[model samples]
Target: EAGVVQSPRYKIIEKKQPVAFWCNPISGHNTLYWYRQNLGQGPELLIRYENEEAVDDSQLPKDRFSAERLKGVDSTLKIQPAELGDSAVYLCASSQLGAGGYNEQFFGPGTRLTVL
Candidate 1:
């Protein structure tokens, strides 16, 4: 059984430094997603993609954060000039439409980012 893959399990960067995280979802999953988990809070949706099209990204901060799911297989999330408030666990998830019109999401061990 294949699972989601993410890189750089942990990262420490100075404020104003650029950072990027990569993720490869399970094969055949059509929906890819990115989320931010702040300390002591549930994960918040940042962006979501459906077969290479960004279906929703209203929560993403356009000025410094960006994401892409090219060909809808692999995805990447980037933060330019990271800020202290941006420190959190960036989660990557994917899912396929199943019976009953529900999508069961599989999550990867998030990449923990710490901005000082």
Candidate 2:
């Protein structure tokens, strides 16, 4: 009954460097999501996975960003050649499918990345 977990709670890197974030969702959860939040802004969905299948990822930048959910359990998100604009808090969330299809996401402490 653990909550979502993320590593390297903070990261600082120069522009053009590659950075990656990891996430471990709660057990028995059928849905996982990755979001990015800029300062003073609400989180924006970057990607969503139903089990191992990526159901939504239109917001993720394909050129320098990639994500994967291995075996429908854990997930990773990467941003290559990072830019200053990419500085934000990356959040991972998970939710269980319950009665009436209620799926309330529980978020993890985000990885705050600062690009210089």
Task: Say which candidate scores most in lDDT.
Answer: 2
What's the C-alpha lDDT at position 38 in model 1?
96
Put down candidate 1 lDDT per residue, 20-104, tens digits, no spaces: 9999999999888899999999999998888888888999999999998887799999999899999999999899943213778
- The clash count of every prediction, one per candidate, is 0, 0
- Cα RMSD for predicted model 1: 2.0
Please provide, for model 2 over 23-114, each residue's C-alpha lDDT reduced to its tens digit, 9 standing for 90 to 100.
99999887989999999999999998898888889999999999999999899999998999999999999987532137789999999999
State the weakest 10-residue window (summed lDDT) of model 1: 96-105
> Model-by-model lDDT, in order?
0.91, 0.92
lDDT score at residue 84, model 2, on the 0-100 scale: 98
> Against the correct fold, how does model 2 do in TM-score?
0.94
Q: How accurate is candidate 1 locally (lDDT)?
A: 0.91
TM-score, predicted candidate 1 vs. hidden true structure: 0.94
Worst 10 residues of 2 by lDDT: 95-104
Q: Extract clashing residue pairs from model 2.
A: none
Regions of candidate 1 where Cα sits further than 4 Å from its true position: 97-101
Compute each candidate's TM-score over C-alphas.
Answer: 0.94, 0.94
